[model samples]
Target: MSKLENIRIEGIFIKEEGRKATLKFDMPFYADSQPVKWADSGYNSISLEIDIFDIHYLEIKT
Candidate 1:
C-alpha cells in the first residue's frame, strides 16, 4: 500500500506537455514551509507546471 498526502493548488489552466500540465496562478506560493515568489511582475499572471503523473484524478465543471 502507498501513503497518500493531500495537496491543494489554485490556478488557471494553461497548457500541457507530454506528461505535464502548466497552470497560471498567483505567487507568494508555499509548500511544506518552502516558499516561492516573483521579483518582477512583467506578465499579468504567473505560471505553474505540474506533472500529470502526480494527479490521481480530477473533476471538471463547465
Candidate 2:
C-alpha cells in the first residue's frame, strides 16, 4: 500500500449524473510502509487526482 502524508486538498468535483467524485491533492509524495525519511524524500510537483465512483452519502468540512 502507498501513503500520502501532509497532503493538502486542492480541489473537489462531484458529478451527480454519473455518481462520481474526484479529489485533487497537492504536494503529494509516494511512500511505502517503511518509516518515512524526509532527508531522502522528494516532493512531487504534480497534482494527484483520485477518482471515486458509486453513490452513497457525501460530506464536506472546512
Best by lDDT: 2
Which ten contiguous residues of candidate 2 have the minimum total lDDT?
30-39
lDDT, candidate 2, 1-62, per-residue tens: 96767888898999877589999997555444434453346643557799899958788766
Top candidate (TM-score)? 2
Candidate 1 overall lDDT versus native: 0.43
Residue 29 CA displacement from its true place in model 1, Å: 6.6
lDDT of 1 by residue, 4-24 (tens): 233234654523433345553
lDDT (0 to 1) per candidate:
0.43, 0.73
State how far residue 14 of model 2 sits from its true place (Å). Answer: 0.5
